[model samples]
Target: MTASLELPDRLAAYLQRSGVALAVSVCEGDAPLMFVNDAFTKLTGYTEDEVKGRNCRFLQGEGTSEEQRQPLHDFVHGLGEDSGRFPILNYRKDGSEFLNYVFMSRIRDSSDAVRYIIASQFDMTNAMQRSKIRQNDETLRTVLSDVEQMGREYGLAMMSSAQQLADSVAMMARLSLRDTR
Candidate 1:
């Protein structure tokens, strides 16, 4: 749905109570957080009182890289459209880290003025870990295949050398017999 349409109170409440994790921030000045749903708290481990009126950057920590923070920074400064699904390493209130996939969009009023920014965060730590495991497995398989190929080549070379040695020994024996005769 387009952000221009004002969400009714009931609809907003429904969103707050919905199963999805989301947070709404007023974009007037510092983009202070205005609302956070129950799911948001459950995901971040921070209560509404702790997060209200604060910038959501509190979720970022040492684990968050500058590259991941740049996109969100550019989006907030009106340098980009929507901040697409970007994965950010974020820390919870208890300092536990998780890969967060964040989607942010601007909500505008009828006059076309920006009113708020709605950000939805999804936990993707498990998916990212699985992807890494698959990549490692592929790398291991490639290494094993190369080693097996080298082994086969070495075996062929050794067999050829043994055949040449046997032929030389047989020729030497025949020459000795001819000399004795």
Candidate 2:
């Protein structure tokens, strides 16, 4: 509520009520933050007024590696993949640092134009609840998504038997990659 947010009632309600720290940024310009929930403020020691309209990179000061930043940067620039997930060291407003696992998804409009990047970030330093289970779940989701993509590409090259068989596996990978939601 610290910033003037314009969103649908349902989306606003969900963002406000989410337990996980979440932030949303518009795709244009410096990708300035547009929305941050109370959980985000609590996790970063910054209130809405201080964080809104700023880039999330404010959380990075020293020790945040270029290796970790490159993947995310590529995602934003359309240089590599369509999504980004990585762990990086992030600083809080109080100068304290934490290992942050960031997951970002691009929200595309009906016409397939990306309008926003919604980020879900978690502080790994404090997360201790059966991470194996969570990791497994995430792995499965990634595999399924890959399988879905494989299928789409496979359908185009089913002419040769050996090629078809090889593509079938890739096509399977594509199908498995689908159903991201």
Q: Which number leads on TM-score?
A: 2
| Model 1 per-residue lDDT tens digits across residues 1-181 | 2343334454356447545466777766778787788989999999999997888899999979999999887777666663345679999999999888776766554445665667767677775578865753464354334333433543422122212222222222222223333
RMSD of 2: 10.3
Tell me how many clashing residue pairs each candidate has.
Answer: 0, 20
Report lDDT (CA) for all predictions.
0.62, 0.64
**What CA root-mean-square deviation does each model show from the true structure?**
28.0, 10.3
- lDDT score, candidate 1: 0.62
* Off by more than 4 A, model 2: 1-5, 126-181
Model 1 TM-score, all chains together: 0.65
* TM-score versus the correct structure, for each prediction: 0.65, 0.67
